[model samples]
Target: MHAWAMGAAVLSVIASGAKAEEVVLSPSSAWVLDYGDHRCRMTRAFGEGPTRTAFMLEQTQPSDTFSWTVAGPLVDRFGKGKVQVQFAPAFDGFEIDHDASLRVAEFGTAVASVTHEAPPPTLISRTAKPRLRSEPDALSDGTARAARLRLLNPEHGRSIARLTLTKGGESVSLSFGSLEAPFKAMNACMDDLLVSWGMDPAELREATTAARWINSVPLVGKIQEFYPAKALEEGAEADYRLRVVVGANGRVSRCHMILLSRGSDFAQRVCDIMRREARFEPGRNAAGEPKPAFFSTKISYRVY
Candidate 1:
């Protein structure tokens, strides 16, 4: 079946509003749905000429968080370590901070789960320990091409798109169909599930805040030194957004690239450099007292 068709089937099932403890199966498609126990989940498998890739999203009760799972033949061969998943349009990518554990299912499919949670500070620091590497190895075997899927959370309108998995320097993209229907269906299922649990759906709304940089840190020198040589040769120019948490002492405690115009490696370099070199004066709360704050900024890069 076509990938987009599979995605549409999955979304249709989700939008059907399955009741508690009921399973919904799409006709002639690899999509399945189960709603119960204060959670709703949808699973879809996309097969392409002997290669099958399965993706699942499960959202628990009373929390705005969800766990995403991807399983396939390629994942079966991955080594245990950090795996980077970069979503398309170039902005949505994240690293699976914890090691992936292989799950052997009925047909010997390998599955890995990445939960949406911040890695421990020590663990983040450890993995982020600077290493002097030139350019990232290019994917020569055409393993990086696959169908992309995006899972949208209805409550907060926040979505995560699964792109390609990079583990131990080898990367492979999972195949999926059109994500629009699936995402919408997932959102509908979530809304129904939330109502079934006797909770206000409004509780899932995302909150916003305004925090300004009290002092700016100069990053041009570091960017110039660490900018990728290949990017320079290609005259690649891009913009990146870094989300950082500043402590009361005016030092950045945690940071990550929330948006990027280039590849994941470049985003990592920007964050690493900023984390080590950037400093700020503490931001004040509404009452004028020093407080830890969240800050974000757009950094633009040009070869010239």
Candidate 2:
């Protein structure tokens, strides 16, 4: 091997195998899969004690993408601001690029999370029918991207994942052992979750569309209305996850929330905002029939 190639190989080994200053944690707990009214989460902790790192992966529907959140003292390694999160886990042959939200507690612990989504640039594969005819708007950009993302589902024999959190020259990496089994459990939980929501799992797999937000431009401004007074007063920060049910009429029927930290006031305010202003283009099933679906996301508030 050339001098440079050998050097690079040695560096890889050092980064993955051992690095004292860098926090590299391995699984210290079993996966806990939770099926909630709005989402499914698979969680596992690495290392031990108060400083141990905890990871949570959540999914709300049958989709290739999922949300990943990590917490604990491991979070203290990065700055309180946005962290460069690179999930290059081979995520089943697909990659994810998005900004991760970071929160540092008053006591100095922190948490970071981000969701994976395939961009609109996903093109048809070689297997696509070359001569198939369809309406110009039938296969929209979003539709094609969803189809492509579905192929990256971790349940499809995805290997172990190493998620790296970076800030300038400093970085910390966490490795999640073979995720195939945990993801399978999460998928099963999701199937039941659909049933609890009165949705047919099989039919949803063939859905022609997922709920789309309408007039969401003002959403951020509206959420800003809350200001999360209690949290700010206590000098605490939090991020809340939510799922809103969209009726066949495309209006938000109800909203549910799960807190990442203590902030009930903020959560309540967000639900109120969603109920009053959230509108959507309802999802449709394979038979072109309107279906009730959910839109899930997370929101954070900063006092400054």
Candidate 1 residue runs with Cα over 4 Å from true position: 1-30, 48-50, 62-65, 97-100, 107-115, 119-162, 200-304
Deviation in Å, model 2, residue 224 alpha carbon: 5.7
* Best model per lDDT: 2
Error of 1 at 179 (Å): 2.4
Lowest summed lDDT over 10 consecutive residues: which window, candidate 1? 139-148
lDDT string for model 2 (1-304, tens) is: 0010000100111243233345566666666777666667776666656447777777655555576777776566564555566554653323233232444332235454435442322111122212212112222432523322132255443555677666545566766645667666666777777677666677656667767776565764555555544555675656555667778888888787666545445567778877887777777776667777666655554444
Question: What is the C-alpha local distance difference test score of candidate 2?
Answer: 0.57
Relative to the unseen true structure, what is the C-alpha lDDT of residue 74 in candidate 2, on a scale of 0 to 100?
54
What candidate 2 gets wrong by more than 4 Å, as runs, is: 1-25, 48-53, 60-63, 71-111, 115-152, 155-157, 164-175, 213-238, 260-264, 269-280, 297-304
Give the alpha-carbon lDDT of every model.
0.46, 0.57
